[model samples]
Target: MKQIGVLLSKNYKLLSVAAILEVFETVNKFYATAGDELPFELNLLASHETIENQKESFGYQLQSIKDVKQLDLILIPAFTSDNMHETLQANRLCVPHLISQYNNGASIGTFCTGAFLLGASGLLNGKIATTHVDASDGFAIAFPEVNLKADRTVTQDGRLYTSGGATSSFHLLLHLVQEFCGNEMAIKIAKVFAIDMDRDKQSYFSTFQPSRNHNDELVASAQQKIESNYHDVTTIEELIKDIPSSRRNIVRRFKQVTGITPIEYLQQTRIAAAKKLLERTGQQMTEIIFNSGYSDPKAFRKVFKKSVGMTPSQYREKFQVR
Candidate 1:
């Protein structure tokens, strides 16, 4: 049996931890009923002997292993924190243990913001990983060496694996099941859990909000203008007219500060506006297209699909407020 350790840390997302545990346990029960041997020995490992919910009112306790070595796979569930830096610093105790486990040939997998801990352990260095879309900008800034594939729902590089936001953890667990157990068993588990087996990307769920945390005032001003005037055919030349820098210099600086070209930013802004309109309003396609500053139906459809991983109609069907 493959030894699997699920790290239970303070401030961890309770539902994710519970879901993962329940899934593996159910699989074990399935194997027993079928007269087959267990495929995995799942354990809850932690830096502490006991972990309490940060919300003391909940009064829940988690029993954890003192030592987490000699594991085939280590799963880190997402932690709840607004400040990624502070979260990583507070969880520093797990860093050395995670590094040691990785060096010993154990694979590491993380769900949602738990990728921050994996990144802090230095295992994600130069490896493609992902996290919650809202946290993508922070993750990229915190770990520049790790290739952040924020659009992907799940990313597996050699022994390292990372999954996107919230319920995407189910997909990651399903993936692990498929890898360790056979396809037939994976399907059985999926049917048992009622998890969609075809979710492969997070692009449909992510909103493309350009990062504006940098100190570039010009870029910030340009972003504000684009956001407010996305319906207008605002050109880069028009944006740079009031700024002191040359068009080329402004474009270069904007790209440096925001990681996206001026045109790309505008496209994202328009798409974001279009998404909101589609979600809340009963606007026709022509009206939404015009309101989103797009005149050509073909061009709008192409950009919408490229950015959203689905057509406008599909996005509305999935996310529109009923």
Candidate 2:
């Protein structure tokens, strides 16, 4: 069994810690039955036993971690702070013990602003990590040694796993559980949580947001329309007309901001919409495809499999109308 450690700090947001705790605890319950065996062990690590309260966002207290050495995976939960020093104080032991843990082959992980603490620890030098977009500048200025990718929800460099924000913590944990336990357990947990079960290491991060500018206003407008009306049947030419920009300019700026062409983005959005419909509606595959802006069943199946690792029928069988 993999030994998991959650490093709780003073002022750490309650939901972040609670979410991680609840998920893992539920996983542990799977093993309580006579025929089931769990794949993980978890512990909460804190610097002190002074009866500290959790961060304001969620109301909870945490257990102190007395022995950091035996942990197989160490997770740092997100906390909000404008001042970097204040954030560090609650979980400062992470910095002093990180290198030693790495040398001994322990996996390091974090969620949201937890990446900021990893950066300060000097353990993330040259590693790819992500934090909240607002923390991007401060993280870069504080830890130029680490390569920060502001847009991603989760990034891994070797054994280090860093996540972006609050909700993304579920994705990060599920990914780790998948890595250590198996895909079956991941699917079971996801179904229990009513999650789409489509997330992977790369599937969940938001790449970039289209910026508003005079030159890119038309492109931004088109993107906004697409997002707002993802269920609507929108073609490339129609999108350009709505934006009032030339096809060339719209494509250029849209790709510049979001790292994909306009058509690609539309297809992605449609697939996302289809996933939601699959979870929420009892619609047939053909109807779901049409509603998600696809005209051909074969083509929709191909695209769904390519983007989400499962065919429409397979997705429905596994997750929808269940």
Candidate 3:
């Protein structure tokens, strides 16, 4: 049987850990029912024997029987923290252990913000990975060496795997089951857990939050204006009118600071506004396009699909309020 370890740390999201264990356990039961040999020996491992549950009251605790070693696969669940830098410092001890495990030929997979912990291990350097879309900016700034694909829900680079946000963990686990077991087992588990088997990206659910954490006051002001006036059909020239910089210089600095060009940022802002209307309103297509500052229907449809990975009507159908 393959040895699998789920590492639980302080402040870890308990539900993610539970979901991983439940999927594997349910698969094992399926194996038994079919008279097949057991495929996994799952264990809860940790850096310490017992850790306080950060999300709960003082009475709750998590106990682990295995240390971070000698496992065929190690899964790191997400943790809750507002400041990632401080959280990483607090959990820095797991880095060397994780590195040792990887060097010893064990595969590592992380869920949601747990990618932050894996990134801390320096193993994700130059590797394509993903985390919660809301945490993409923070992850990029913290580990610039890692390629953060915020749109993808799951990414696998050789033995290293990462999944995006919350229930995306279920998708990642299903992927591993399919890889190690078979499609039949994966499909069985999906039906057993009621998981959507087709979700592959988090782009549809991601909101475009503009990066304003830089010290560039002029660029910050320009961003604010773009967000507030996204429906005004404002041009880049008009955007830079209030700022004392050349168009070329402004575009250059905007890209440097936000990692996206001014026009791209404008498009994102407008699309984000459009998403809100699509989700919450019963407005027609023309009204949404106009309210989101687009005059051309063709241009709006093209940008919406390109940005959201779906058409406006599809997005609305999936997310619109009743």
Candidate 4:
């Protein structure tokens, strides 16, 4: 049996761990039911301290990272905490272990924010990866060397794999199955799990929540202006008219603090407003477009489609209140 090690990282999400174990266990059971040898041995790997505390709770053989010298595959579960920086720090013990295992030819797959822990190991440097859609901005800012493809449902760079938020994890798992077993086994798993294998871009599921964790008052002032006036203007000059800082300074500091340019921020704010209206209102398309500060229907449709992966009518048809 090929060895599969699932790292129970600090603040690891219970559902993520459960899903990883269940999928592989099901795969193993499939072979056993067919009178063939089991294909995988699932190993719960964690730090020594965590192993002692969670061993009995997991009710499975838990191995410390120090004892796991070789693994054919490694799975990292998403973290529960919102502060991924602190969570990553808590899981620093896994960093060296991840690097060593990858060097030994073990493939690594990370689910949701679990990519943060893997990215911390420096193996993701220059590799395209995706994380939870909401965490994209933070991921990009934290690991500038890594190519962050926030819209992709899954990304594979050589042996390293990363998936987007939540249910997106299953797609990555199915992909691994395809890689190790075959496409037929992957299809069987998808059928058993009732997973729609058609998913690709994750953009449609994302809500544009701009960051508010910075202390720059000037940037704050610019943000307030943009949020308050996003519905009435298009140009950055018009949006930041009341802000005392020069346009150049505000743009630099705003991007520095928010990881997006002022124009991009304004577009996101407008799109957010439009999304809310689409979800909660019976407003006409024309009125919705006008209220969201777009003068041209074509431009609004273009931006909305690019940002949301659907047309305005399609978005409203799927999400509008009855």
Least lDDT summed over 10 consecutive residues: which range in candidate 4?
A: 51-60
List, residue by residue over 120-194, the lDDT tens digit for candidate 2: 777899889988655655576677778887656567899999876766788788887788768988888888877
Candidate 4 structure lDDT: 0.90
Residue by residue across 209-252, what tens digits does model 4's lDDT show? 78899999988888888898888876999878788888899999
Candidate 1 deviant stretches above 4 angstroms? 49-66, 212-215
C-alpha lDDT score of every prediction, in listed order: 0.84, 0.72, 0.85, 0.90
TM-score of 3: 0.90
Residue 105 lDDT (model 2): 83
Candidate 3 lDDT over residue span 1-322, tens digit each: 8888787765688788888888998889989999999999886765552444332222223334234348799899898876777878877777787788888999999999999999988899999999998888778878889998988989999999999998899999999999999999999999988889999888888878777778998789889878878788558777668888888898989887887788998998899999999999989999999999999999999989977889999999999999
Which ranges of candidate 3 are over 4 A from the true structure? Answer: 49-68
Q: Report backbone clashes per prediction.
A: 0, 2, 0, 0
Ranked candidates, highest lDDT first: 4, 3, 1, 2
After TM-score superposition, the amount by which residue 281's alpha carbon in candidate 4 deviates from its true location, in angstroms, is: 0.9
TM-score per candidate: 0.90, 0.58, 0.90, 0.97
Q: How high is the lDDT of residue 186 in model 3?
A: 97
Best by lDDT: 4
Name the lDDT value of residue 26 in candidate 3: 89
